[model samples]
Target: MVEVRMRVNGAVRSLEVEPRVSLLDALRDHLGLTGTKKGCNQGACGACTVLVDGERINSCLALAVQYAGREVVTIEGVAADGQAHPLQEAFIRNDGFQCGYCTSGQICSAIGMLAEHRAGVPSAVTEHLAADVELSAAEIRERMSGNLCRCGAYNGIVESIQDVAS
Candidate 1:
Protein backbone atom coordinates (compact mmCIF):
# COMPACT_ATOMS: atom_id res chain seq x y z
CA MET A 1 0.00 0.00 0.00
CA VAL A 2 1.19 3.49 -0.78
CA GLU A 3 0.13 6.61 1.00
CA VAL A 4 -1.61 9.14 -1.20
CA ARG A 5 -2.85 12.49 -0.09
CA MET A 6 -5.23 14.55 -2.22
CA ARG A 7 -7.63 17.37 -1.63
CA VAL A 8 -11.10 16.06 -2.44
CA ASN A 9 -14.11 18.33 -2.62
CA GLY A 10 -12.12 20.95 -0.66
CA ALA A 11 -11.13 18.53 2.08
CA VAL A 12 -7.79 16.83 2.53
CA ARG A 13 -8.12 13.09 2.08
CA SER A 14 -5.23 10.78 2.85
CA LEU A 15 -5.31 7.05 2.49
CA GLU A 16 -3.21 4.01 1.81
CA VAL A 17 -4.24 2.19 -1.31
CA GLU A 18 -2.87 -0.28 -3.78
CA PRO A 19 -0.84 1.33 -6.50
CA ARG A 20 -3.05 -0.20 -9.14
CA VAL A 21 -6.30 1.10 -7.69
CA SER A 22 -8.04 3.60 -9.92
CA LEU A 23 -9.06 6.98 -8.55
CA LEU A 24 -12.64 5.98 -9.18
CA ASP A 25 -12.36 3.04 -6.83
CA ALA A 26 -10.57 5.04 -4.19
CA LEU A 27 -13.19 7.71 -4.25
CA ARG A 28 -16.16 5.37 -4.12
CA ASP A 29 -14.76 2.60 -1.97
CA HIS A 30 -12.48 4.47 0.36
CA LEU A 31 -14.07 7.89 0.57
CA GLY A 32 -17.69 6.91 -0.12
CA LEU A 33 -18.15 9.51 -2.84
CA THR A 34 -20.23 7.38 -5.16
CA GLY A 35 -21.62 10.19 -7.25
CA THR A 36 -18.86 9.55 -9.74
CA LYS A 37 -20.25 6.54 -11.55
CA LYS A 38 -18.29 3.59 -12.82
CA GLY A 39 -19.45 3.04 -16.36
CA CYS A 40 -17.39 1.59 -19.18
CA ASN A 41 -14.32 1.38 -17.01
CA GLN A 42 -12.30 1.41 -20.19
CA GLY A 43 -12.59 5.22 -20.11
CA ALA A 44 -14.85 5.52 -23.11
CA CYS A 45 -18.12 6.28 -21.35
CA GLY A 46 -16.92 9.24 -19.29
CA ALA A 47 -19.22 8.16 -16.47
CA CYS A 48 -16.33 8.25 -14.03
CA THR A 49 -15.22 11.70 -14.98
CA VAL A 50 -13.99 14.01 -12.22
CA LEU A 51 -12.18 17.28 -11.92
CA VAL A 52 -8.51 16.98 -11.19
CA ASP A 53 -7.07 20.41 -10.54
CA GLY A 54 -10.14 21.91 -12.21
CA GLU A 55 -9.76 19.82 -15.37
CA ARG A 56 -12.10 17.01 -16.26
CA ILE A 57 -10.49 13.58 -16.43
CA ASN A 58 -11.69 10.00 -16.36
CA SER A 59 -11.02 8.86 -12.85
CA CYS A 60 -11.21 5.27 -14.03
CA LEU A 61 -8.16 5.86 -16.20
CA ALA A 62 -6.14 7.52 -13.44
CA LEU A 63 -4.33 5.65 -10.73
CA ALA A 64 -4.97 6.73 -7.18
CA VAL A 65 -1.27 6.98 -6.41
CA GLN A 66 -0.69 9.26 -9.37
CA TYR A 67 -3.14 11.80 -7.95
CA ALA A 68 -1.16 12.41 -4.81
CA GLY A 69 -0.95 16.08 -3.90
CA ARG A 70 -3.53 16.94 -6.55
CA GLU A 71 -7.00 18.29 -6.01
CA VAL A 72 -9.85 15.97 -6.90
CA VAL A 73 -13.46 17.07 -7.20
CA THR A 74 -16.23 14.59 -7.65
CA ILE A 75 -19.90 15.39 -8.31
CA GLU A 76 -20.25 15.85 -4.58
CA GLY A 77 -17.76 18.67 -4.68
CA VAL A 78 -19.45 20.93 -7.22
CA ALA A 79 -22.02 22.16 -4.79
CA ALA A 80 -20.06 22.31 -1.57
CA ASP A 81 -22.35 24.87 0.03
CA GLY A 82 -25.53 22.82 -0.54
CA GLN A 83 -26.74 25.31 -3.14
CA ALA A 84 -26.28 23.66 -6.50
CA HIS A 85 -23.68 24.89 -8.95
CA PRO A 86 -24.97 26.86 -11.89
CA LEU A 87 -24.43 23.89 -14.16
CA GLN A 88 -26.34 21.64 -11.81
CA GLU A 89 -29.23 24.02 -11.67
CA ALA A 90 -29.08 24.43 -15.37
CA PHE A 91 -29.07 20.69 -15.90
CA ILE A 92 -32.10 20.28 -13.70
CA ARG A 93 -33.89 23.21 -15.23
CA ASN A 94 -33.08 21.94 -18.70
CA ASP A 95 -33.85 18.31 -17.93
CA GLY A 96 -30.45 17.30 -19.16
CA PHE A 97 -30.73 13.82 -17.75
CA GLN A 98 -33.08 10.93 -18.24
CA CYS A 99 -31.94 7.80 -16.43
CA GLY A 100 -29.52 10.02 -14.54
CA TYR A 101 -26.67 7.51 -14.57
CA CYS A 102 -24.38 9.83 -16.47
CA THR A 103 -25.60 13.06 -14.93
CA SER A 104 -22.67 13.56 -12.58
CA GLY A 105 -20.05 13.00 -15.22
CA GLN A 106 -21.89 15.18 -17.67
CA ILE A 107 -22.12 18.00 -15.16
CA CYS A 108 -18.45 17.74 -14.23
CA SER A 109 -17.40 17.58 -17.87
CA ALA A 110 -19.52 20.64 -18.67
CA ILE A 111 -17.92 22.61 -15.86
CA GLY A 112 -14.46 21.83 -17.19
CA MET A 113 -15.53 22.44 -20.75
CA LEU A 114 -16.80 25.91 -19.84
CA ALA A 115 -13.57 26.67 -18.05
CA GLU A 116 -11.56 25.57 -21.05
CA HIS A 117 -13.67 27.71 -23.33
CA ARG A 118 -13.27 30.71 -21.03
CA ALA A 119 -9.52 30.16 -21.13
CA GLY A 120 -9.66 30.48 -24.95
CA VAL A 121 -9.27 26.80 -25.61
CA PRO A 122 -10.52 25.82 -29.04
CA SER A 123 -12.40 22.72 -29.96
CA ALA A 124 -11.96 20.83 -33.21
CA VAL A 125 -15.06 22.49 -34.53
CA THR A 126 -13.67 25.96 -33.98
CA GLU A 127 -13.88 27.78 -37.32
CA HIS A 128 -10.67 29.73 -37.08
CA LEU A 129 -7.50 28.90 -35.18
CA ALA A 130 -6.41 32.50 -34.58
CA ALA A 131 -9.74 34.16 -33.99
CA ASP A 132 -11.66 33.99 -30.74
CA VAL A 133 -13.69 30.79 -30.73
CA GLU A 134 -17.41 31.21 -30.54
CA LEU A 135 -19.35 28.84 -28.29
CA SER A 136 -21.60 27.83 -31.09
CA ALA A 137 -23.92 24.86 -30.85
CA ALA A 138 -21.57 22.81 -32.98
CA GLU A 139 -18.63 23.78 -30.83
CA ILE A 140 -20.49 22.81 -27.67
CA ARG A 141 -21.61 19.54 -29.17
CA GLU A 142 -18.13 18.73 -30.40
CA ARG A 143 -16.51 19.62 -27.11
CA MET A 144 -19.00 17.50 -25.20
CA SER A 145 -18.85 14.51 -27.50
CA GLY A 146 -16.65 12.64 -25.11
CA ASN A 147 -19.56 12.45 -22.72
CA LEU A 148 -22.31 10.25 -24.09
CA CYS A 149 -25.83 10.08 -22.80
CA ARG A 150 -27.25 6.65 -23.53
CA CYS A 151 -30.68 7.92 -22.59
CA GLY A 152 -30.65 10.23 -25.59
CA ALA A 153 -30.56 13.38 -23.52
CA TYR A 154 -28.14 15.09 -25.86
CA ASN A 155 -30.54 17.88 -26.69
CA GLY A 156 -31.16 18.80 -23.11
CA ILE A 157 -27.48 18.41 -22.24
CA VAL A 158 -26.46 20.74 -25.01
CA GLU A 159 -29.19 23.19 -24.09
CA SER A 160 -28.16 23.19 -20.42
CA ILE A 161 -24.54 23.81 -21.35
CA GLN A 162 -25.55 26.59 -23.69
CA ASP A 163 -27.68 28.23 -21.02
CA VAL A 164 -24.81 28.13 -18.57
CA ALA A 165 -22.30 29.31 -21.15
CA SER A 166 -24.46 32.28 -22.03
Candidate 2:
Protein backbone atom coordinates (compact mmCIF):
# COMPACT_ATOMS: atom_id res chain seq x y z
CA MET A 1 0.00 0.00 0.00
CA VAL A 2 1.15 3.51 -0.81
CA GLU A 3 0.31 6.46 1.36
CA VAL A 4 -1.19 9.31 -0.63
CA ARG A 5 -2.23 12.74 0.51
CA MET A 6 -4.36 15.06 -1.53
CA ARG A 7 -7.01 17.72 -1.17
CA VAL A 8 -10.44 16.45 -2.17
CA ASN A 9 -13.56 18.60 -2.16
CA GLY A 10 -11.70 21.20 -0.13
CA ALA A 11 -10.58 18.73 2.53
CA VAL A 12 -7.20 17.16 3.03
CA ARG A 13 -7.33 13.40 2.65
CA SER A 14 -4.63 10.88 3.49
CA LEU A 15 -5.21 7.22 2.79
CA GLU A 16 -3.30 4.02 2.12
CA VAL A 17 -4.08 2.79 -1.34
CA GLU A 18 -2.64 0.18 -3.64
CA PRO A 19 0.02 1.68 -5.87
CA ARG A 20 -1.91 0.67 -8.94
CA VAL A 21 -5.33 1.74 -7.69
CA SER A 22 -7.06 4.17 -10.02
CA LEU A 23 -8.14 7.54 -8.75
CA LEU A 24 -11.70 6.75 -9.79
CA ASP A 25 -11.76 3.69 -7.54
CA ALA A 26 -10.19 5.57 -4.68
CA LEU A 27 -12.79 8.29 -4.95
CA ARG A 28 -15.73 5.97 -5.28
CA ASP A 29 -14.75 3.15 -2.96
CA HIS A 30 -12.52 4.77 -0.38
CA LEU A 31 -13.69 8.35 -0.17
CA GLY A 32 -17.34 7.62 -1.00
CA LEU A 33 -17.40 10.16 -3.84
CA THR A 34 -19.66 8.18 -6.10
CA GLY A 35 -20.70 11.07 -8.29
CA THR A 36 -17.92 10.18 -10.72
CA LYS A 37 -19.10 7.18 -12.70
CA LYS A 38 -17.21 4.28 -14.18
CA GLY A 39 -18.75 3.60 -17.55
CA CYS A 40 -15.62 2.24 -19.25
CA ASN A 41 -12.76 1.24 -17.02
CA GLN A 42 -10.39 1.37 -19.98
CA GLY A 43 -10.63 5.18 -20.26
CA ALA A 44 -12.11 5.25 -23.75
CA CYS A 45 -15.19 6.83 -22.22
CA GLY A 46 -14.84 9.96 -20.13
CA ALA A 47 -17.34 8.67 -17.59
CA CYS A 48 -14.56 8.75 -15.04
CA THR A 49 -13.37 12.30 -15.71
CA VAL A 50 -12.19 14.42 -12.81
CA LEU A 51 -10.00 17.46 -12.22
CA VAL A 52 -6.53 17.02 -10.85
CA ASP A 53 -5.16 20.42 -9.86
CA GLY A 54 -7.74 22.09 -12.16
CA GLU A 55 -7.08 20.00 -15.27
CA ARG A 56 -9.52 17.35 -16.41
CA ILE A 57 -8.27 13.79 -16.65
CA ASN A 58 -9.60 10.30 -17.13
CA SER A 59 -9.43 9.24 -13.50
CA CYS A 60 -9.67 5.60 -14.47
CA LEU A 61 -6.32 5.95 -16.26
CA ALA A 62 -4.64 7.80 -13.41
CA LEU A 63 -3.18 6.10 -10.39
CA ALA A 64 -4.18 7.27 -6.91
CA VAL A 65 -0.54 7.61 -5.89
CA GLN A 66 0.16 9.71 -8.94
CA TYR A 67 -2.00 12.50 -7.54
CA ALA A 68 -0.41 12.65 -4.15
CA GLY A 69 -0.39 16.21 -2.72
CA ARG A 70 -2.47 17.47 -5.63
CA GLU A 71 -5.96 18.89 -5.61
CA VAL A 72 -8.46 16.33 -6.82
CA VAL A 73 -11.88 17.66 -7.70
CA THR A 74 -14.63 15.25 -8.48
CA ILE A 75 -18.13 16.10 -9.66
CA GLU A 76 -19.18 16.24 -6.02
CA GLY A 77 -16.70 19.04 -5.49
CA VAL A 78 -17.82 21.22 -8.41
CA ALA A 79 -20.65 22.91 -6.59
CA ALA A 80 -20.15 25.90 -4.34
CA ASP A 81 -22.08 26.18 -1.11
CA GLY A 82 -24.73 23.83 -2.51
CA GLN A 83 -25.05 26.04 -5.59
CA ALA A 84 -24.30 24.34 -8.86
CA HIS A 85 -21.34 25.48 -10.90
CA PRO A 86 -22.20 27.56 -13.94
CA LEU A 87 -21.38 24.66 -16.21
CA GLN A 88 -23.71 22.38 -14.24
CA GLU A 89 -26.44 24.99 -14.42
CA ALA A 90 -25.81 25.40 -18.10
CA PHE A 91 -26.03 21.64 -18.62
CA ILE A 92 -29.34 21.57 -16.78
CA ARG A 93 -30.67 24.56 -18.69
CA ASN A 94 -29.62 23.07 -22.01
CA ASP A 95 -30.83 19.57 -21.21
CA GLY A 96 -27.36 18.25 -21.92
CA PHE A 97 -27.89 14.72 -20.65
CA GLN A 98 -30.19 11.70 -20.82
CA CYS A 99 -30.08 8.57 -18.64
CA GLY A 100 -27.73 10.76 -16.58
CA TYR A 101 -24.94 8.23 -16.51
CA CYS A 102 -22.66 10.65 -18.33
CA THR A 103 -23.90 13.91 -16.88
CA SER A 104 -21.31 14.13 -14.11
CA GLY A 105 -18.44 13.40 -16.43
CA GLN A 106 -19.76 15.68 -19.12
CA ILE A 107 -20.13 18.58 -16.75
CA CYS A 108 -16.73 18.01 -15.23
CA SER A 109 -15.16 17.75 -18.65
CA ALA A 110 -16.89 20.90 -19.81
CA ILE A 111 -15.64 22.81 -16.81
CA GLY A 112 -12.08 21.68 -17.45
CA MET A 113 -12.41 22.31 -21.17
CA LEU A 114 -13.54 25.85 -20.56
CA ALA A 115 -10.62 26.43 -18.24
CA GLU A 116 -8.24 25.11 -20.87
CA HIS A 117 -9.69 27.35 -23.51
CA ARG A 118 -9.43 30.31 -21.20
CA ALA A 119 -5.79 29.48 -20.74
CA GLY A 120 -5.31 29.54 -24.54
CA VAL A 121 -5.05 25.84 -25.20
CA PRO A 122 -5.81 25.14 -28.83
CA SER A 123 -8.21 22.45 -29.89
CA ALA A 124 -8.05 20.53 -33.13
CA VAL A 125 -10.68 22.81 -34.60
CA THR A 126 -8.98 25.94 -33.43
CA GLU A 127 -8.29 28.17 -36.41
CA HIS A 128 -5.81 30.50 -34.79
CA LEU A 129 -3.55 28.88 -32.27
CA ALA A 130 -1.76 32.09 -31.32
CA ALA A 131 -4.88 34.04 -30.50
CA ASP A 132 -7.45 33.63 -27.76
CA VAL A 133 -9.47 30.52 -28.49
CA GLU A 134 -13.12 31.12 -29.16
CA LEU A 135 -15.75 28.72 -27.92
CA SER A 136 -17.11 27.71 -31.28
CA ALA A 137 -19.29 24.65 -31.69
CA ALA A 138 -16.56 22.86 -33.58
CA GLU A 139 -14.01 23.70 -30.93
CA ILE A 140 -16.30 22.57 -28.13
CA ARG A 141 -17.03 19.37 -30.00
CA GLU A 142 -13.40 18.69 -30.60
CA ARG A 143 -12.37 19.42 -27.04
CA MET A 144 -15.14 17.22 -25.66
CA SER A 145 -14.60 14.42 -28.13
CA GLY A 146 -13.05 12.28 -25.43
CA ASN A 147 -16.36 12.17 -23.59
CA LEU A 148 -19.09 10.06 -25.14
CA CYS A 149 -22.77 10.26 -24.32
CA ARG A 150 -24.48 7.07 -25.44
CA CYS A 151 -27.84 8.81 -25.13
CA GLY A 152 -27.13 10.93 -28.22
CA ALA A 153 -27.12 14.18 -26.31
CA TYR A 154 -24.32 15.79 -28.30
CA ASN A 155 -26.37 18.76 -29.38
CA GLY A 156 -27.50 19.52 -25.88
CA ILE A 157 -24.02 19.00 -24.44
CA VAL A 158 -22.49 21.26 -27.02
CA GLU A 159 -25.14 23.85 -26.43
CA SER A 160 -24.56 23.74 -22.68
CA ILE A 161 -20.82 24.23 -23.01
CA GLN A 162 -21.35 26.99 -25.55
CA ASP A 163 -23.75 28.71 -23.20
CA VAL A 164 -21.26 28.59 -20.34
CA ALA A 165 -18.43 29.67 -22.61
CA SER A 166 -20.24 32.74 -23.79
Alpha-carbon deviation at 30 in model 2, angstroms: 0.4
RMSD of each: 1.6, 1.3
Reference-based lDDT, each prediction: 0.92, 0.90
lDDT of 1 by residue, 105-154 (tens): 99999999988888777789776543344578888899988898999999
TM-score each candidate: 0.95, 0.96
Candidate 2: where are CA atoms >4 Å away? 129-133
* Clashes (candidate 1): 0
Clashing pairs in 2: none
Any residue pairs clashing in model 1, and if so which?
none
Candidate 1 weakest ten by summed lDDT = 126-135
Task: Give per-residue CA lDDT, model 2, range 65-131, as digits (tens).
Answer: 9999999899999999889899889888999988999999998898898888887787887876543
